[model samples]
Target: MPDYNGSVDYLKKAALRGSRLGLERISELMERLDNPQNRVKTIHVAGTNGKGSFGAMLTSILTEAGYTVGGFSSPALTGITDSFRINCREITKKDFAEVMTEIIPHCEAMEDKPTEFEVLTAAAYLLFFRKGCNISVVECGMGGDTDSTNVLCFPLLSVITNVQKDHTAFLGETIEEIARHKAGIIKCSRPVIYGGTDLTVSDLILREAKKKCSEFYSTDYFRVSDTSSDLSGTEFSFDGMGDFRMQLLGKYQVMNAATVLTAVEVLRGQRINIPDEAVRRGLEKARWHGRFEVVRREPYVIYDGAHNPDGIRSAAESIELYFRGSDIVLLIGVMADKEYGLYTDMLGSRIRKAFTVTPDNPRALASDKLAEVFRAADIDAEPFDDLAKGVCSAYEYAKANGLPLIALGSLYMYGDFMDALNNITE
Candidate 1:
């Protein structure tokens, strides 16, 4: 808990303390930051998947409409700690250092030192408020009810992207329980946008929204058509709205875009004046780092941080759709908390060969453990010492074998993979 003044080492030092899930520490820290979250209008987004990309899309459109946008995303696509961004740029090291300096003593003065996530959340809002952004798009770090970001009152909109079964240990095991946690973001009277396909989960959300009398807009209620995905982006047609395009690929984004558009329409009805041009521009510019990100050309290296089974299945489907008929070699690493058998079962049946490695996080599942899971499934999983060596070996194997390759499993692997990939390119 040292002062964070303008040191490039702020993250390295702060990151050392590591992640501990829970929001009481963050709630306390934010109170010391003058609760900047309340000063700005916010669009609170939470779901099992696609919420991050949806948040990116929301920020993009809000920015295009000339709003100074503040964004806070978790598990930063890269390892840069405190991926708090302002006006669409990652908070610079100097800014991070300065803000940490400002908030540290306040955090220390509190009952206890703030947890990393709490400090980061407080820093994001304080920095955004200081930078003078009109609105912020905040993605929940974990569940919604007690989530640190949930402190925002009167968020312009609460977006529940999609609820799926992940984080069963902390959140809940049943879909209803998971939905309840996500639906907790719905303010008493604020507009709530629901954008996912699971009926059981969607039903839980709708039930909550009705109980609160919050207006709900769902993709199932919208008339969407002519959706297409290519490497460039996705092109789609809407019912009330005509043609719209987004830089993000896959059919799933069409629903995500619909959710964004639905929120925009609600905002417009409330006299927000978000022009169609802004909406189009926002969809075009939305850039989330790791979801089905194509990292290389020539041999077509792709990266997807699909740690859970639902995510892995979705990524696999996207692969079959986008890179159909191409033989695939997968490079994988995952955390210990996830359901390994389910995840591997969903992905193993799709790819030709698989390679396993453990991520750098202490919570990571050992490579041998992952190998055993795949092997039991009759998959020939080659275990590597670590992510770096695994990725290198996989890349070489793919090169020698002349097949398309995919690197996935956990977002924790992204920083190392991205760093390694960059080094290779350089």
Candidate 2:
């Protein structure tokens, strides 16, 4: 059996092939391994945003309902192992190594070697099947139609959470085109739930659901009667479902909860046996890190992976809602492919000062270029090639000036920012 480092290295080598979006390679690889994905029940979630939050909430609810739940997501927060989880815990290094040992030879023998994500998806399915997961929740890495996770033939449910203009190079440039890509997860005769408010996007999804002959549900079906949120947490009520509270902060999270609650109702209709108590407890306990996550309270530092335009707008709105009248320091880093101009423009006026850093990725936008964008938008901006220095400067400025510092942009930078914060605090 391979050691953990060796297995991780193997996966990294596969990643060198890069993101080839299609199901052919994954399907062939899974077939070579006897297709373990077919043995498990799955809920497929696809969207530009909120996929992780929705998946986590659903997994928590399933686990709370006393089922062995498996969860698969992508671009893990801290480590690759975080992508494969059971009962909210990442697969142990030993288990990850064992699974890699079992699959690497098959991967090597394949005529067209699978990409890293495809291999990981196969590994997750095999692990969940072998470990006896009662149900599995899979979040699509990108567009639903061609994502590796689309290999699942029939999922228990498909959720499309708020389609936005992202991954335009692959998905599409227009919202309607993007909506079509997200809508591809809807299966024949299955059920689908959508959480987006855009009428055009929702109508497109509705039409796709109709074409698939699937039962459709939307966030419009649920009414959020009362809602309150701060950096600490969010509390809200779903008309008849009762009041729920969660550690995840933001108005968007409240909408995500409404989507999950609507999904719970659909699950109940399908006789899943999820009790109201389970839903309440699951929402209360479910935590998705790196989205408005507070790492320190004294200087009031927040880290959010709001890389896209819509996400940046939401983060800006949350800042206004929670820290209005306070000086806000912005620490930003992002991938080169994103609309950095739009992102900076959306939150520029609110930012008292900006510190830009390059995220740790090949596609990272240069810190100097990001600083230029912020400066062009009339926000005071500075650039740093080193994340540690950037974070330190931001923290010192925020503390000295009595301002709240927010770190936003690419998820790739989160680990670096977290490490820097820990070092400074220590």
Candidate 3:
């Protein structure tokens, strides 16, 4: 049997085979594995952004209601295993290795090998079913139509957190094109909820749901009022859903929370017995890291996974809202393919000095090239080859200058952030 490291290396090599976005390989794997996805109820989440946050919130609410729920998200914050978790507990390395052991032989026998993401998605389905999860919240890897996670035949509900320009290379260049792919997750006769107000995107999703005879609900009507917000957290009220508080910083989070309440109401309509107390408790406890997360205090170190335009805008807004008058420096690492115009346009004003590091990923943009982008913004920029060294240098500079430091960009770098922070504290 393969150990954890061996299993991870095998998947890494499998990733080199590249991502083939379609359901054929996944469908075959599911059929061979006895279709465990259908055995467990799932809530399909797809969108350019906020899918992770929404899934985390729903998982917390369901767990608070005493149901065993599994959650699956991408670019695993805790490495590969964290991508598959139950009730917020990451799958153990031992369990992951054992599952890979069972899944590998089947992969080897396949005529057309499954993509790395497809294999992982199939494994998550089997893991959720075998672990006796009453429910699971699954986020699509990319566009919904061909994403590996779209294999769910029927979901309890389908959620599109928002529609935006992302993954344009494959999802298409326009908002409508990207939205069509995202709307494909709307299963027949199932309830579908959308958290975005882009009229074109909403209309497409609504039409798709209507075509499939699915009930459609949009959270656009929900009124959200921010009661209070500080570095600690935010307090808000979503119409009749009652007041709630969450440690997740940013006004955007308030929007995500409202969408979550709308989902709870939809679940209630479906006869799922979730109590109000559970909703309140769940909101208070729900946390999805790497989105405007403050990792250290005193000198103030923050981390945000704002790899794209929308995310960059949100992080910039939150920084302005929280630290407008304070001195702030930035530490950035982004993908080679991401859109960068918004990065400088949105965050340029807040940056005092910038440190660039190449994230630990195959597609990461070179640190020096990223620094060149920063320098174009007319901000002082420096590049470091070693991520940990760059992080320490950024923190030290921030400390000496009496400025807060925010590390932003690719989610793939979060694991590296923890490692770098450990080196600093130790």
Candidate 4:
């Protein structure tokens, strides 16, 4: 039997084969596995941002409603195994290794080898089927149409959360093009709930739903009112569902919760039987780590994986809303292909000092290059190749100057930041 570390290493090697986005390899692979994805009811989620959080919330709601739920999300926050969850708990290492061992032989036999994501997606489906999940929430790996998880033929419902400009290289260069890709998840006659406020993008999605004969619902269906947030959590009331609170912070979360609520309404219409009390408790209990997550208090350190322009803007807005009138000491690390300059421009005025570090990935932007971008924006900036050194510098500076520290940029840097915080606090 393959050990946990060995199994993970094998998956990592498959990842080196790179992202081959298409349904053919995944379709063939799932066919060999007898298409377990079809055996279970699924709520397929797709968008540039908010897919993970939305899926997490939906999973929480279903779990609280007394249903066994399986969740699959991409670009694991902690480890590869974090991407697959049963009842909101990550898959155990032993189980992950055992499942990989079972899947590896079939993967090796494929005429065209599946990508790491494809393998993982297949594993999640099989696990969900074997475990008898009442339902599953599957977040798309990338653009919806051709994403590995799109192999689901008839999802119980399709969710498209707020389209934005990211992954332009593969999805498209424009918002309309990206929306088309996102809308690809809409299956014929299935209900789709979209949370995006962009008129152009929303219209495209509506059109796609019409073309596919899918029922379409929008955020307009539910209004989020009396929204409030602090370091603890966010509080908001949705139409008919009053006074809901969530551990997930930011106004963006209110919008995401609205999407989840809208989805619940549709599910109820389909005879899912989710209770109102379950919805309230689920929102309050759902936790999505590394998004405006506060790690420390004295020096006030926050870590947010806001790598894109729109995401960074939302992070900046949340910062201003939460810590208004306080200057932020920013620690940033990002990928080479991200819109780092735009990120700086969006939050530059609010930042008092900046420390840049390279994220732990081959595609990470060089620390010095990131520093140069910040410097050109006229913010005091320094670069460090070593993430530990960068964290130390940012921490000490924030402590000495009495300013809050915020770490932003790539999700890949989250582990490094957490390690740094652990070292400092210990």
lDDT of 1 by residue, 1-426 (tens): 333443335445556666666667877777767788899888899988887778888888888999899888888767454477776777776677666678767866876566666767887788888889898989998879878788887888899988888888889888888889889999988989888878887788888999998988776534788878887778888778678887776546677788878888888876787888888888888887888887786577888878887788888888888887777888888888888788666776666778898888888988988888888888778998667777877777778777778888888778888877666541
Clashing pairs in 2: none
Each prediction's whole-model lDDT (CA): 0.79, 0.89, 0.89, 0.89
Better of 1 and 3 by TM-score: 3
lDDT of 4 by residue, 201-297 (tens): 8889889999999899987634778888998888887878678999997657788888899999999988998999999999889988788888898
TM-score of each: 0.93, 0.98, 0.98, 0.98
Write one digit per residue (lDDT tens) for candidate 2, span 1-426.
568999989988998999999999999988988988888889899999999989989999999999999999877888888888999888889988988899999999998899999999999999999999989999999999999898888888999999998999998899999888888889999999999999998889999999999999998634896788887788888997898899998668888888999888988887899988999999988978888888899889998889999999999988988898776999999998998889766787778999999988999999999999888888899999999999999999999998999999988778888989999952
Worst 10 residues of 4 by lDDT: 219-228
lDDT of 4 at 415: 80
Q: After superposition, how far is residue 366 of candidate 2 from its true place, in Å?
A: 0.3
lDDT of 2: 0.89
Separately for all candidates shown, the number of backbone clashes (residues 3 or more apart, or on different chains) is 1, 0, 0, 0
Clashing pairs in 3: none
TM-score of 2: 0.98
Q: Flag regions of model 2 displaced more than 4 Å.
A: none
| Cα lDDT for residue 43, candidate 4 | 96
